[model samples]
Target: MAAAVTASMQPKSMTRAKKWDEVVENAYRFQLAGYRDEEEYRSVKKVDSAEKWDNGFVKKLQRKDGCFYYYNKARECSDKDVPKTKLYNY
Candidate 1:
C-alpha cells in the first residue's frame, strides 16, 4: 500500500515541476494551426506539454491576419515582402 502511494505521488511531483512548459507550449500550439482541430488540439496539448521541459518557453508571432503564429523571433524571416511574415517589417 505504501509503495502504491509513493508511485502515485511521484507522478504528481513530476507534473508540478514541469507545469510552466506545458503552459507555454499550449499557448504556442494554440497560436499555431495545431489547435485548429478541436480533437487534435486536445491531444497535441497533452503530448507537447510532456515533451517540453519547464524551461522551454515558446515565443509567439504576430500575424498579419490578426491571428498569432508559433515561431521563434530569432529564426523568423526578416524580409518585408514575405506575405506570411509579420505585418510590421520593422
Candidate 2:
C-alpha cells in the first residue's frame, strides 16, 4: 500500500511560480493596507478581502499560523498615532 501511494505521487507541471506572481504579491500588499485603513473609513468605504487579496500569503494572514508575520515582519507596520486625519483638533 505504501509503495502504491508513493507511485501515485507525481510532480505538477506548474510547481514553479509564474511571472504574474509579482502582480498577485502587489495586490496582497494593497489589500493589507486597505484593510487597516478602512478601520477609520467604515462609514465612507469598505475594503473587501475577497476582492483584494489576490495572493494566498496575504489571505493566510487571517489564519493562526499566518500571524507569525508579526514576528518576521514586525517593522512593516505599526500602531503609532494612526496618522493625521483631515479634521484638525486643538
Candidate 3:
C-alpha cells in the first residue's frame, strides 16, 4: 500500500522581515516605533503572517476591519514611548 500524505507534510512558505514590515505599514499608516507592547506586536505579527501566506507580501497594513494604512520609514518612535492604540472598536 502507498503511504498517504499528511497535512503537516505540505510545504509552507516562509515570510521575510521586509514583507512583514510592508504588511504592518499598510495596516497602520504610522511609524511602528519598533516599541510595541508584547501582545500588540504579536497580534500584528499574526496578521502579517496570514497576509503573507495568503496574499503574498504587499506594501500595506490591512486591519481586520479591511482598512489599509501606510507607514513612514525614516520616522520612528523611541523604545521609552511607543505609541499605543486599540486594535479594534466595539
Candidate 4:
C-alpha cells in the first residue's frame, strides 16, 4: 500500500511556480496540509477531490493528523509565495 501510494504520488519533474494561478493555489494549500499535492492528498485521504469554491479555489483541506483547514474565497497565494510553491508534473 505504501509503495503504491508513493509511486502514484511521485512527480516526473518539478519547477518553482512563476506566477499565481489555480494550480499554484492548490499546491500551496496541499503543502500547508502536509501533502505534496492533490494526488497525494487524495491517495492518503481516499477522497475523490478537495472541496472547492464556486470560483474553483480550494474551500477546505484536511491535514494528515485529521484536522480540517478552511479557506476563504479570496486569493490565498501571494506573490511572495509564488516562488516557493512548486509545480509538479506527473
Candidate 4, 1-90: lDDT as tens digits: 355486656899999999888989989988878888889888988899999999988899998788999998998988999899988899
Model 1: lDDT to the true structure: 0.33
Alpha-carbon runs more than 4 Å astray in model 1? 1-26, 36-50, 53-90
Kindly provide the TM-score of model 1 when superposed on the true structure, using C-alpha atoms: 0.21
Cα distance off (Å), candidate 1, residue 48: 7.6
Off by over 4 Å in 3: 1-59, 78-80, 83-90
Most accurate candidate by TM-score: 4
Judging by lDDT, tell me the better candidate of 2 and 4.
4
| Regions more than 4 Å wrong, model 4 | 1-4
Q: Can you write out model 1's per-residue Cα lDDT over 14-65, one digit (the tens) per residue?
A: 1111222333344434435433222233343333332222344445433324
Candidate 2: count the clashes. Answer: 0
Off by over 4 Å in 2: 1-20, 35-90
Model 2 TM-score on a 0 to 1 scale: 0.19
Considering every candidate listed, which one attains the maximal lDDT? 4
Clashing pairs in 3: 26-60, 26-61, 26-69, 27-61, 27-62, 29-70
What 10-residue stretch in candidate 2 is worst by lDDT?
81-90
Name the 10 consecutive residues with the lowest summed lDDT in model 3.
81-90
User: For candidate 2, what is the lDDT?
Assistant: 0.28
Candidate 2 vs 3: which has more lDDT: 3
* Residue 52 lDDT in candidate 3: 28
Clashes of 3: 6
